[model samples]
Target: MSHIHIPDGVMPIWFVLAGWAATAVILYFCMRRVRDVELGRKIPLIGIVSALMILGMTLDIIPIAYHINMSVIAGIVLGPALGFISIFIVDLIISMFGHGGVTVVGLNTLIVGTEAMLGFYFFRVFLGVFGAGRLSPGMSAALAAVLSLIISTCLMIGVVYISQINPERVLHVHKENPLGKIFSLEPEGENKRHKIEDKRIDIETFAKTVFSLGVFGWILEGVITGFVIRYVSRVRPDLVLSEVT
Candidate 1:
């Protein structure tokens, strides 16, 4: 739900370059912090998580373009550093398939990876708050996923608003409901009237519209991630890296 679908040449060059610079610095520190033995252990896990995310992304729910990011689960299992690198790999590969523009891969990675890291840290926080013995791992996972997604959605809304992409161009309307078509971009000239109506919306309106759409997606992702994490925790606790306890 938080994925940026803006094509290359649409977003300004400076923002795209800044994305790359920021990602490079994160990768540098992550690489330096991880030990060789941990790296060797993480590579296989990274590959598995990356593949799952790619597959999840490729299979969208249509119209809404909603897909499971699975980034929170990845963050819990792989840790923030490797999770970020894994997201970079997934985003880059998908761009080659024309899923997103090549120029904006860096920005996409940062946005998505930030949520993954947030999910990881927030999972710990939520687990603590809910009380480890009182709350199951599944519930903790679900709560964490929702909180992380909320943060990601808000951050993405800010980025889009700041970029000044006409809210009219970025969103559309359906059946006379403005919020119905949040983030549903179409080819230029597809629906002039819809664009005209969208222009009437300000950034606050746009943010509210997108958040409404996001609520459903977040719930679905949270439930699925929660169950999956619970299963892994029960069957193979060693593979579950995050401190869900």
Candidate 2:
């Protein structure tokens, strides 16, 4: 739901290059850390999780531009390293389908990967905070999902706010519109009045709108994540939070 949908040409060149460089560095480290045996075992799990994420991203609620990311679930199952790889793959595929732009893939991957990392660590933290005996796996997952989403939302908003400052170029509007010429009798300050009437978006409005729209989707995903984690904990106990359980 928080993924950047803006196309390639819109973002400054420096941002695009930085995104690719950062993603490459992270991928290199992840590859170095995982041994051949562990990599082989993770391949199938990565595929399954990537497929689920891609599918979730494809469906959006039109009115709100919202969709479930399933980032927390992937994090819980795959942990941070493999989860980042999975998110990159998923973002790459989604870009090909025009869900997000190709050049922005690295940026999108980084943003979503943050969510996975936060989700995974927070899940463990919550478990520890509540103590093993006090909280169920479902409740722990739900708490993690909620907290992670809040953090992810802040990160995304920060990125957007940063992007808007000192952009590569600015277009100055000095010429009057053809429509204005045609409607010569239009009152002075009419455009400004109309802009105010329509409520031009600023940082405050954008932030409010984003969170307001996503709050419900986030909660729904949190509950679903809790249930899925609980099920996995019951059956394939070795796959998730095994030590604590």
Candidate 3:
């Protein structure tokens, strides 16, 4: 559910590039902060987590129209810095394999990384608020997953808006195409020809589609994150607290 499956050439170049630049900046800061930490031991764990996320995404549930990303689980286990890096690497590998477009890799990373970081922080906050109980961690993970999906959806809308809304340019392109005839139909007596060419991209329609497909998946993601976090809290609480203090 967390992985974006949208194809290449769908989103505008500027939107993709902007997402990449933002991701790069965030990664730079994350790396700088973690520079003093011991990364040798963490590298193997990162690889394992990345592989698990990839595998989880591949095991899609039919009829759901979504795939489990396991990004929140990674964030909960690995902490934010390493989790972000792990997700970035995973997205890069997936893009190379043509699972998603190469151009939108940064956007995809941002969406997945956002889920990871948010899940990590939310888990920590929930632990503090609920006294580190098993159930509390689980609740945190669930909330984080839902929030991450909402944020990613909004980012996707922005991409769609930028790509689809260009009145004058669209008109110019329509003038040069055979499809222009469809948009050039003359108006009848009482009814005006609905200008398909001039019709604005409906943001509400986009939001509705995203929300329809995403809401249920978000709930399922939350449940999975919650269960995993609860188990981790019981078996390996130290991993959860290592980055907090």
Candidate 1 residue runs with Cα over 4 Å from true position: 166-202, 242-245
- The digit string of per-residue lDDT tens for model 3 on 1-245 reads 44556676545445667779988998898788778888887788889999998887777776453687888888888888888988899999878878788878888888789878877877677667877554777787778777776776676676666555443333332343354433422111112233344455578986788788788778887888788777877798776566631
- Give the poorly placed runs of model 2, Cα more than 4 Å off: 61-65, 133-135, 165-201, 242-245
- Candidate 2 on 64-145: residue-level lDDT in tens? 5478899988888888888888999999998887888998888888888888888988888877787765337778888888
Model 2 Cα RMSD, 1 decimal: 8.2
Clashing pairs in 3: 1-67
Cα lDDT for residue 31, candidate 1 = 72
Whichever of 2 and 3 has more lDDT, that candidate is: 2
Candidate 3 RMSD computed on C-alpha atoms after optimal superposition onto the true structure: 6.7
lDDT of 1 by residue, 143-242 (tens): 9899989888888887776666654544434434453354233323345444354353267887888898889999999999999988987888776654
Question: Model 3: which ten-residue window has the lowest total lDDT?
Answer: 184-193
- Candidate no. 1 TM-score: 0.80
Candidate 2 lDDT for residue 121: 89
